[model samples]
Target: MYYPGQEAQLRAAMAESEAFRQQIEANHARGPAEPSAAPAGSTADSSSGASGGVQTQECPRCHGSGQCNGCEGTGHKDVTDAVSGQMGEKKYSSEMCRTCGGSGKCQLCGGKGRTLPIW
Candidate 1:
């Protein structure tokens, strides 16, 4: 047995899910890239290199995950209520970890939290 509007809702949900999956796939395709190295003869410190060097550390704000913290990496924050089609304050519920994509690892360090020397 099916309801009149149920099918439409189901289809909409499916479409939204597919769209989200595609977006996630596209994002994951980019993958994690190695940080660029500093110019030759640069005297950057052993820890936290200079501006020339690539950002070896993950973003504290996004945790190198490149997703919003308030939204739990969903990018879209929840709204408690709507007024005349207007949105309210942003909110969020539990979701997969953006840093490791729920793997619970540091993407920059690949969960190692540190990079190995080129040598």
Candidate 2:
């Protein structure tokens, strides 16, 4: 805990990291979610393996990058594990992101950078 003279440096790094985390969260909250289904007569893009061309518009979530916002393109995330009943809940660790399967891609797009539609 005692860096002798690196206190300022450490604090600055921590602040920067927190700011970055906040930015990622804010960006994630500002996007248009993918639609559930197509308009009825639409068809899926078999060639692209997309949702039969049901997408009405680009997903605001990843801007069509299909990258997962949770891991920020890192394909990994930090998580907490429960060790025991009461105290177990306090335990924590980092692991591969289940959302993107360590691929850092969006769930809806499946790393294809797009979404599917249904009728």
Candidate 3:
């Protein structure tokens, strides 16, 4: 038989653990919902191949802005570069482009500035 107090403590601990698990699951399910507009050098599209592959556009997460704060409109936080070890301002601007958001696209042709015949 278990002690009365011991059972209560165990139950409380289990409840706390479950709550934490749910929080983590919820976080993982939600992801950034924007396009990143950082320079091409800072990003890459590995899935895109020669013939056919996933098209890589700006990171919607950053909205092409490289700072993390949505209010600030930047996709990165203010921190020293790991490699350079230098202090610098990292941020993204929303003034990029209303249409392509700085990607320079008509959306109809994926920024090609031209549309193909739908034949």
Candidate 4:
């Protein structure tokens, strides 16, 4: 059940989640934030400050690619079904990935390939 650096990775992920939650709470307490005006002559884009002043990061779960992890981007995966009354017996079947719903997108990022701090 243990892998190298798994504990550290889990702790880091937990800390990141906690920090994100706190940021959301603080933003909510301060009321709706006004979007800052983009600099003159600057191109408006999603990666720019024009994105409502909210910063986005590559999705940690999908690494910003939006590829389905469960099915390895194939939109299908092999599933093992347990047989009733048969010890250690199993049935193998290939089916659509529940995580991505057969769309071959990251479940966590909702296929955006990136994640915003917004709730």
Candidate 5:
């Protein structure tokens, strides 16, 4: 099934991209920093199973939104079967997201969108 507020989500996503662009620009304005500025034992990569000194890290599996990537949080998947109908016909249907079991959440994070520090 189509999730409610998809249009709103799209708008929000656009706004978020704008905000992210602004953030990048702001970071650029700060200019370059010394390599030693970063603390030891910390890393910039968030998806490397390391928390980089933070108490918790955003779940890499869902990108911190707690949404199922397989279905984009709609909890449904549109499937087309090529040989399910009359000659050369295709059948289309929607089904629950197998990755999330219809709950629309990331299996790794359990809808919290965060995980304990791996470091």
Candidate 6:
């Protein structure tokens, strides 16, 4: 919430914004989080692949957090819907991110969320 007329609300909002910024900085300094295990319904996106072998790497995009740069880690994206029968473009819609394959993981790392050595 923002209120230019209300000084108190504005101050509170500023403080909250500052706190959030600090938190984000801290998170970045610590680096992206690692995946301890697998994702739902897909071994290929997990620590193990279809062959049952470990397939992981530090996400270059998310620094090993398994988030897609295209969607900022969100597996889905909000898009403007097509025009209706009468109306023009409609509201936003969500769909799986093609880059990350809806797993919010680094395709290179197989969503393991671990930064590995370069080959």
TM-score of each: 0.27, 0.36, 0.26, 0.42, 0.42, 0.35
Instruction: State in Å the error of residue 66, model 5.
Output: 0.7
Write the number of the candidate with greater TM-score, choosing between 2 and 4: 4
In the range 12-112, model 4's lDDT, one tens digit per residue, is: 98899999999977875774343353332222235543323445657778876789888767787645555476665544346777878888789887877
| Model 5 TM-score (2 dp) | 0.42
Per-residue lDDT of 13-69 in model 6, one digit per residue for the tens?
Answer: 899999999997776566434544444222233333333344344456566566666
Clash count for each candidate, listed in order shown: 0, 9, 19, 0, 0, 7
Q: Tell me the TM-score of model 4.
A: 0.42
Instruction: Write down the lDDT that model 6 would get.
Output: 0.59
Give the 10-residue window scoring lowest on summed lDDT in candidate 1: 35-44
Q: What is the C-alpha RMSD of each candidate to the true structure, in Å?
A: 21.2, 21.3, 18.9, 17.2, 18.0, 18.2
- Per-residue alpha-carbon lDDT of model 1 for 2-107, expressed as tens digits? 6886998888989999999998777657643433444332222345442333324333444445544444445343445555565665554455544445544445
Tens-digit lDDT track of model 5 for 1-119: 44876988878988999999999787656644654664443335455553332345677789789988887677787465656566544332467878888888889988878766565
User: In model 3, how large is the Cα lDDT of residue 82?
Assistant: 50
Q: What would the per-residue lDDT of candidate 2 be over residues 1-119, giving only the tens digit for each residue? A: 66689989999999999999998777556533544434543334456443322234354577667789877677778544544446434322357878777877787766665454422
Regions of candidate 5 where Cα sits further than 4 Å from its true position: 1-54, 80-92
